[model samples]
Target: MPLAHPFDDDKLKEECGIFGAVGVADAANFVALGLHALQHRGQEAGGIVVHDPVHGFNSARRMGYVRDNFTSHEVMQTLPGNVGIGHVRYSTAGNKGQTAIRDVQPFFGEFSMGGAAIAHNGNITNADALRRELIERGSIFQSSSDSECIIHLMARSMGRTIPDRMEEALRKVEGAFSVVAMTRTKLIGVRDPLGVRPLVLGKFGDGYMLASETCALDIVGAEFIREVEPGEMVVISAKSGVQSHFPFRRRQSRFCIFEHVYFSRPDSILGGRSVYETRENIGRELAKESPVEADLVCPVPDSGTPAAIGFSLQSGIPYAMGIIRNQYMGRTFIEPSEQIRNMGVRLKLNVNRALIRNKRIILVDDSVVRGTTSRKIKDMLLDAGAAEVHFRIASPPTAWPCFYGVDTPQREKLLAATMTEDEMRDHLGVDSLKFISLDGLYRAVGEAEGRDPKAPKYCDACFSGEYPVAPTDMIEKGFQLKAAE
Candidate 1:
């Protein structure tokens, strides 16, 4: 067998998640809970903004997991508003160049139309072009986020009202996105024409809400109404209730498949498919594609567990947790300098020497971007006396940074963008490595659907380099030459 570099086990998280709710007595508190449910989508930072009819507005944003950052009683007490929105961000548009408070969301803006707070989950690839146009027209920008570009475009468009201007601004931009904006009055929800991201409508008795995933709705006791139609916008207000509009009709619907495979919480329902079921299907598919007679089948850690179960069942191999993740690993941990930034990956995960020693192990993980973390994991397994470590990636290699809000490494840095599968195996020092084909992945997640809710056809551009939207300057600059589909 040809030995190439293999994928690492400590994969860097790149997807971002968002949530919004209104008409609830404690919208701010409700959103905080929702954000906690969607926390797995991001870990770098989290924030929530509430609009008070009489008290103007209050917002809170801090770096870390949603549970630690926004769900605290101290933090919730400070945010008081009946309408609110929250965000968990990963830098697809802007790296952590300026991790200042200004860059955080909901990116509150005070404009002539009104004070608006926005939280977004996808990237606007055309943001750079739009921002340059707005800059020429004398618009000052606060952050490098492509999300701000939408707001600038909204201000320039001569729409009669906030909703009209928002629709106009969305037209000028292109790419995968699901956004929730709170103007002084109504809470607005928008999905890109391609529906590259997810947006759902939910209800909580006298109030209604919109969130990135149904899991968020479950946290706050809001019953899921339905998946918001692709290329559609829904506005919720005290006077109008829930109003839906399709600013731009799309011939096809294409939501990101990674949400079910990796981005969403295991229990969440996205694109009408259960994330857990989709993951389980991935394992079933993996077993069929490349079944290995091993002593045991084990997942890298948390994310890959469900698929691991399916793999074990289909292949008839015993499933085990050969690796232990230190869930307490803080958001930011550095000894002192940038020289050892990747060191934390090891601290975050360790091998179960007792379980792995002298065993032929199959390690199934979600995806591999940079191979640095994987190399360490392989070494850890080797040191623990594993007889052999065969690796399998549940998804195809990620060759592109998700312009729709997922913060991944620049193109050149993405191992799959430059290296072939064999080359990657050699780098990561594994006995063998295989990635699930895109077709195999599609069937895995697709077969999991039962009925009722409609599902988008799925955009697999990160693994395929087939972006549904064109990238903006910041996206181009941030991701570099290898970033395209």
Candidate 2:
């Protein structure tokens, strides 16, 4: 399979996707479908752990796409269970190699309570410190993933029950996490205090479902049963049905705003709003915030399409297919070298010469990261005889790297972290460039009055650099924080 999509190399990457099902017939099969729907969240590897009363626990983890690895009857037959949890991984904490498979998740730990399998969907910012502490105490780690810290923590907990152990484990951990886990009879789900990542509860017939997004629930024909509230844990089993526990100190929810911007699939619903509609609203906000005269408003394609349409309607510029993307290409194209990444863009996206010849174009994209892709696209448009290239970005400048779940470039590597709008425009050789203001983004995402200076509605750390969760590990490791440029 292709390593990554050319256009996506410049985007923030979500670390993983998690799904769990309890009291379902062919539980692994339903979990597989849920993971397939959430495939956009992570593509590196996929795994599922199921528990059968007769056979105990069974697991299968493999590198590459879910369809290639998990869709077979042979694989499904082995995972015979009524309760299961699954994970699709994209590495954020570990190095890439043969050993990387060891980090492939739905990481199983045989606790004294019982065998508990977990699929975690966010980063644990203080994991390094926790890992060291655990290791020094004779805890043997099986993988390099930061998520394994939870397993070890749970193992050491004195709680008599599995859920109690899990709650005790989470209370000591720090940072964004949405976790789905399973024991022989119960499936459990939890979101961090900030709700930095998403976890939703769903129901299908007598079974219960838990996933990162509503789209996954739709795939399994599950009814949306509200989100697993932040700092709350839900345990589902045949006997208990569903039990809810608020185990952490209550805090204001800080859902990752980037979920609407780029990470989530357009069809998914987040924060009670359709992701596609939210994106269109973002485009409308972008148009109102930064209007420009142009022959056409052209999207970067796929991720940028919804916003581009909204921009076209609001700006009165006809939308055109100026850049065509290779439909077969994956969301990410992992180039081993810079030389290949530079050329991969051309292979993935081709300028529509007939539509763009001598036309003034407004390029609408989600966000500009390193600016390398933007620069290449500008060159491509100029080469295709475009009279002018103006850029209208849907979100505010990404000035900080995410320590939550997203794999963001360091501060220095982020173009917005160092360069002014004019500087970026000059660097990309664009006629004009503008990004929607932070307040405007809030308005688009349904906060009509804009972001509250004191208590923001969502996590805008990547743009405003106001991190809800402290990067404790990074600070301890001597990573300096610079003011937003």
N/CA/C clash count, model 2: 5
User: What are the models' TM-scores?
Assistant: 0.89, 0.96
Best by TM-score: 2
The reply for model 1, stretches above 4 Å from the true place, is: 1-12, 69-75, 92-94, 111-113, 332-345, 447-456, 472-485
Cα error of candidate 1 at position 468, Å: 2.2
Q: Which residue window of length 10 is worst by lDDT in model 1?
A: 1-10
Q: For candidate 1, write residues 1-485 as lDDT tens digits.
A: 11111222235554567888878787888888888887767666778888887878888888766766765688788877788888876543345433555667788776677788877777776777777778998999998777888877777778878889889888877777799999877899998888877888898877888888898899888999998888899989867799988999665777777777877788888766788988998998988988776898989888889989989988999999999988755444433345454454566788889988999999998888787767777888898999999888898888876666666676778899899999999888898898887778877877444211234367776787665555755446654434333
**Which runs of model 2 end up more than 4 angstroms from their true locations?**
5-7, 93-99, 331-342, 482-485
Scored by CA lDDT, what does every candidate get? 0.78, 0.90
Q: How accurate is candidate 1 locally (lDDT)?
A: 0.78
Q: Compare the candidates by lDDT and give the number of the best one.
A: 2
